[model samples]
Target: MMSKLLKNRYLILRRIVQITILALYFGANAYGWKVLVGNLSYSKFLQAIPLADPFTVLQMLAAGAVVGVDVLVGAVVIAVFYGLIGGRAFCSWVCPINMVTDLANWLRRKLKIDRDARRINISRRFRYWALGTLLVVSFVVGAAAYEFVNPIGFFVRGLLFSIGFGWTLILAIFLFDLLILKHGWCGYICPVGATYSLIGSKSLIRVEHNHLNCTNCGNCKEVCPEKQVLNPVIYRKSGFINGIECTNCGRCIEVCNDNALKFSIRSFLKNN
Candidate 1:
């Protein structure tokens, strides 16, 4: 039953759309395409009539020109599409690097060597602290700091530089993902994930567990990539959400045989 639902047409379509967008993004970045369809650029083109490259927006935003039309437009698009639809849906399903990470995770699971289940003793509070530090650094040192830690940027650079030269460091991260980690870069590191997680907290769409129907079967916890759903702080709803680490990948929902979870949207103003 779980497998059938996981293989549902909607999920398959979602995955296809995500992969298509990610491929276009990679092509635009690597091949210097003037126009790409079904991506942020396409939407930007429709809005502005003369599409601005993402690099230009990145530069202007980095220089503290946040009030410009370009910045505003970009922010709205990112927030509405990526943040509101599903947190890090872009990262989980639409990122080329994330595709690679998923592939690695699959191999690790097949090998029975996955270590992502190991509980780290690090304070959950540290995620918030790290988020704060990234925001401050982005303001102070600029997007360069954020870019350095962004998996998207890292993957693009790795593809360009490391793939050609066969760099050991790049290969190591790839191998680490395949051997010891399950979306490790995403769950533990990836500043872009951190950024998206923050933006997505107040997003309209969110996952809700129907505790009344829940059997406490722990299936959701077992398959959750973020593993936060298992934490009492979040599971018990000690707060709106315990942390911003959730990617909203829907794997938990897919794994729950009891159909105890669902994603629904809420108005930000009304909820607040």
Candidate 2:
């Protein structure tokens, strides 16, 4: 019963987030309210949020003497609040990219095709290779190489572009999701996911698996989008799961019929 309730809540949250993203896309483009918030140019907003282009923060970090304390603080706060709150919960729940990914997964499931690419027999090292390439390109070329692959950008372009072109692009993503890869764009391609995973390693909030209650029925493994829960290393851990790849989607917890899973937070400093 509890598991069902959590699943329902997840579905509700997913729909609400998708609706919000669609509204924001149309609202920002149609009404220009995004401009009102920060006087930020469209290109500037894209640069700041997704592309991380121009590498302003990296440049600041490189200049070790006079660091931008304000920027650092803002970045830290966002990372902790979002990243540390159960890995990639922000991505799966709030990110515009995730909305599109969910759509892709749905299309794939409808077609009876594998939606995730990670199921392929490629070495896990491929993720590292992709990450390296994205970082090098971002730094060297001063271009948002990963932005072109970003689902958020794709969704934005889909909404703002000509209807024919926009729908075409969306359809292409849907087809790719159905035919080519499961979470192909998200798991291996998304630089944002990679970045979040790195910062979220230290996250206080995480999933806890109760081995005593867990029957090892593998429901969580079967339902996991990222398949991180099934890894031998994670399965061996006690109580809270600390895998960096965990997205905190709560799917595992939601599906655990035995109520063997939960979310927990650990404090860094003990009270005196």
Candidate 3:
């Protein structure tokens, strides 16, 4: 049990972060708690500092909205924070949708769905295209178009505010990842994730690889959501997992019994 807990420490920590954020949101709404107010798109931290999602702000900008100074500050705060840390960390650590999709992924593994089912070969680059298309649509529609159908927004809002078909959208994503594609919504389609990936491309914190320690057991690749990022380092070379697509979820690090992978600060002087 101790060994199991140690192995899954990162996963457990991520869940705690994810759940704690949601609980704070729920508390703010239901009990008027001021610890963290507002939704993920925009929020006032501790009723003083503003925190905003930069991607949402971008959509507002694309839609020709007059974004307020505070909101802009909040967006900058978030962008800078993620730019220094891991950008898509939001997808794994803060997004409520992550729980649903993760459950679907777990079910996929438990049910042997990954082995028995036909795999889909969607290019990961499709997310970047989706991000671009969303901006274009936001410009043309005079609104943040993606916001209407965003599962993250829906799940968070539905949890704290109202249910109103949000569960259906969440369920669809769950099924999509479970049945259609592995890591489908997050890996292949979320423009929000795409935006974060771009912002955190040069983040300091990264999973570093020590090829000398690797056993080539493939445990890390089996659990990594972005396994392609490991290709250069898992068995081939020693360096930071530099792919912007990496969420820095630390699953690869946690699962590696060989100690080949661990989190480290990226070296600016060295080519990663």
On TM-score, the candidate that comes out on top is 3
Best by lDDT: 3
lDDT-based ranking: 3, 2, 1
Clashes of each: 0, 4, 0
Instruction: Please rank every candidate by TM-score, starting with the best.
Output: 3, 2, 1
For model 3, what is the alpha-carbon lDDT of residue 184?
Answer: 90
The stretch of ten residues in a row with the least summed lDDT in candidate 3 is 263-272
TM-score of each: 0.69, 0.72, 0.97
How do the residues 1-272 of candidate 3 rate in per-residue lDDT, one tens digit apiece? 99999999989999999999999999999999999999999999988899998888998999999989999999999999889877568888888888888899888888889887897888999998998898999999999989999888888898888979778888899999999999898888998999999998888889999989989999988988887788877788888999888898989999898899999999756747
Tens digit of per-residue lDDT, candidate 1, span 1-272 = 87685545345655786666556555666786545523432234323433332332443465475545755566566666655666656556555566666667767767777444553344434545665566666568655355454445455555434444434545665676665555566676655566667767666666666666677777777656678644653345322222356666666667667767766665667642
Cα deviation of 245, candidate 2, in Å? 1.1
TM-score of 2: 0.72
Clashing pairs in 2: 115-181, 115-182, 116-182, 117-182
Error of 3 at 176 (Å): 0.5
**Model 1: residues with Cα > 4 Å off, grouped in runs:** 1-11, 26-72, 83-85, 114-143, 154-170, 180-182, 233-243, 267-272
